[model samples]
Target chain A: MAEVRVENVSRSFGAHKALDDVSIAFPDGGFYALLGPSGSGKTTLLRQIAGFDFPDSGRIVIDGKGVERVPVEKRRIGMVFQNYALFPNMSVTDNVAFGLSVRGVSRAEIAGEVQRALDLVQLGGLGERRPHQLSGGQRQRVALARAIVIRPQVLLLDEPLSALDKALRVDMQVELKRIQREVGITTIFVTHDQEEALTMSDRIGILREGRLVQEGSPEEIYDHPVSEFAATFLGDANILRGEATETGIRLGDGTEIATRLNSMVRMTGKVSCAVRPERITILPASAAASTTGNRLAGRVSKRIFAGDSSTYFVERDGQTIKVLVQNAGQIPFDEGQDIVLTWSPESTVLIRT
Target chain B: MTSAQAARKGIRPALPLLAPAYLWLTVAIFLPLSAMAFFSFMTDLPMAGREWSLTLKNYAAFFSTSLYLTLLWSSLRLGLEVTAWCLVIGFPAAYVLAKVLKGRAREAIFLLVILPFWSNGLVRIFSWAMVLREGGILDTALNAVLPFTVSIDLMYSYPAVIIGLVHSYVPYMVLTCYLTLQAIDDSLIEAARSLGASRRQVLRRLILPLAMPGIVAGAVLIFVPVVGSFMEPRILGGRTGTFYGTVIEDQFVAVFNWPLGAALSFILLAVVLLILAASAPILRRAQQ
Candidate 1:
């Protein structure tokens, strides 16, 4: 396993810059996720690390050695594509043994390694089948086995689980995490799905428009997104426009919300308040008077029961904000009913607009 | 009505839609072929403008003649060579056209590749004759720099026939291979590269295997035409122009032996069918 370091990498096609001055270092034996939407340079970055593409202006080092001149095969990086591009002509055993065979390993060793790789992916007895005979999940596992069988320095997966159905995707995600841990290979997984990134990654690097917007643990990304884009992209957030003052910012409806601000930050500026849906609590009118912190009087515009939880669309000051309440008991309110939305000072994050 | 009767009624109304093309094929193709087969079994008229009789003399004569057998073998050999050459040159050109060029550039290149086929075959052969003859354009171009005499007589030879056949059939081979290569998903190569296969490995393992169907189809197309071709060898092969096609033409024109010509034509058809049948299983396996 090798640590991968990308320094000031930039790539462009004509006028469209796919990656621009992006730099990141992945430590040895950790799962790093490059999380971003489509056209956000996640795949480009992964391809560069795999030595499939060269950066226009930067250097990449694997295990403290510069790999700019090394060819893809010599770099010894294994990659799993999104489509699980297994060789249709080869059986599963031959597909997994392709790398070893190309590198001139002995036939006896190849047979043993192929079987071990197949067994690692939970497909011990399926070496004779073609890719078309396998399901989407099975094909993806075959692709994974083929990638890791040679014990590459780095393992790169470009949205590998995106092709499977939801149930299969979840199962494969758990399997992938287990396999990665077992192998202890430095892996870089590129995915746009926040849930997948959060679940599988040791550290998630959220990218936007070819730039790293935030890099942190899943909880940090969820609870402490530094920008409006980061907060909105990671999860649904109710954004309230406000202004910063000595005590707190005044909402558009002239309601004063008490908030704690960093002392270093100036108070004379426009700010936005972000709150998660589940963080806001809906209370009865009798309990509204006793509530503290930020409270707003609103009417339930729409209430939807989504199996395990009930979602309330509360309209406050001409803005509809969503509040998710667990369906442990009866719903707190019905559609078009008046209710008080309450949240603690800590729940509302003050972000610069 | 009964259910069976209702179903028969439903089927009866749509049968006319399939009739016209089948009738045309039967009358235009199968009927003539059957007539030719029947005539091949008949004896040729002893004198000009005479009548026909039931005899296997034509077939017997074709197998008995050493000259005719040699010509048949030579034609089949030339056909194989032309097909092999077309494939060797056409596959890479088609690959470049389909995978490297894009948009209007690809279309432009394809058009250029196919442009030779748009001209009449007689005109194309005459043009090649001009280039291959002594003191022709090719000789003149070579003589400009070389001190030695560049005018060698190249017009009437086996090489000339093979060259003409390849030139005529290369575009068809390229088109077949291009369509096959174009249909292959590029992601397959990308996947191979990401899996640590080099560029040469990608071409050998992914491209050649996937394009095998088109290669086989092109080979069949080029081989069938070159083997049965009379015009190229007649114009280009002067003394060496004694191919199976020339003999078939001779029986019809010079000898006025329709029965013998028909028998020779049937033999050639059988040879082509045999080759196709022999290759089908191999091609099918390659595709799988």
Candidate 2:
């Protein structure tokens, strides 16, 4: 419903800085995820946008209005905590109706709104049950329903699906995306799970050590990570360190691996190229290599079969390269067998560090 | 079988482990209560060279006498007043201890709250006497600050008795309420605030409802004792302290009528039990 922008926000607790000069804009009606490891300030940034805590220096604007100093209750932001935090003393109906009742909505209107909100979350007839009576997934729905029923300007979720089991978490992720789309509210989701962020958000901001390391579409960041940390943290990547050359980088073993040298990197000194595991094709060493792509000949030291795909750990010049091959009725490669790995120049991202 | 039934059966193996506590209760509590019940139905104490017989005269006397009933009513009123004051003063103190203060500061303040228990109850009551009596510490402090001279004679008054009882029992309220308040998750408060509930609304709608068990517990702890309290009223109330407890004490020590004293004590116990039974539903609901 509204664009929320955090600009140059810095917050400190005693000697430790929780958030350091972090800024990210959540566009109107867009689902943005703040992803980071623990203590990386993703939750801190979310709290700042929610107005739970004020930044030492910065401005938080909602709908073009300065609101960094406004208290949480008046900011019109709804948050679902990691634990769901449903009021155990009240039934599900009262829990969803809490926001409307607090704002002094009419009694009849509150009832209608609560029912609609519950139905939106696909929990239509669970109004009479207490929080303790509901299952883990049901409580999550009630928590979501409670937040969005108030029609907040922005919805903030802090690791909302972390409490559910894996299967339930996957189901709720889809359900959550559907509800957000249906409501058409700008939502800021904070999570440490990289897969959840990549699968759920329109734009993902990766944070580390109180700084925004990368922010872009999930595919953009995945395809072109600026640094080794971004490449490795966002997904699995095999980094090959080498000396930069005109066309590519020459590895320590005197083998030149081709790279496109995108604008993010310059070929003048030592560099690293990140190749995704799934992007590399594994071929028997006896077969002829492809005419125009980076290739590495190595022996398969280990192979992991995970139902539908296999991950082969290839050893070349004392460095391990991983290649993911889908299980498609081809005879699996055995350990200690020689293989040639090939990936296109565009799939290999060159990084300066 | 249902889990509850399974659980009940599971407790059977531990029944032997519970014997010592049950034995201690039987010897220390139940036996004395049974003796008292027997004495309340007697015509007189069967002492050396004394006559005794079973009779309903003790029960008849209690029902027929207006003075006894009136004093019982007044004692119940006193208990209610003392409990109300303790709650009004202790709940906020508990909230501060549980939610506001943290770390060593919280521990230090909590020590201060329960510090009264470290001293003897009589000593604490007598200390209040020193503060409330005319020309006492409070009087001197007030007279030193006020522009006009006024007598600060609060001793031997109803408010003096109420104040003394509340002081002696407020820690019970604070300790009980603090335990429950501290168990509330901080995120619940944040969730309520994020939902546009003001501070006052959060307290009323969330905190109060969640802490009801503690309030009910503290009220029981304070009310039951204050109803039968003779020391606080006798020490603080002076001539105005002629409630059911003092009268029962008089029958035993001054009148030398054991039968009447025992009868009076039984009636008081019955009244307390009736009140507790009446509020059992509310207490059960609060726990849920």
Candidate 2, residues A1-353: lDDT per residue as tens digits?
89999999999999999989988899999999998899999999998888889999999999999999999999999899999999989999999999999999999999999999999998999999999999999999999999999999999999999999999999999999999999999999999998999999999999998999999999999998988988999999999999998877899989998887577436678899899999999888888754579888899999999989999999999999988999999999999998888889889888878
lDDT of the candidates, in the order given: 0.87, 0.92
- Tell the DockQ for candidate 1: 0.58
Against the true structure, whose TM-score is highest?
A: 2
- Model 2 reaches what TM-score against the true structure? 0.96
Best by DockQ: 2
How does residue B133 of candidate 1 score in lDDT? 82
Candidate 1 positional error at A309, Å: 0.7
Q: What DockQ do the predictions score, one after another?
A: 0.58, 0.76
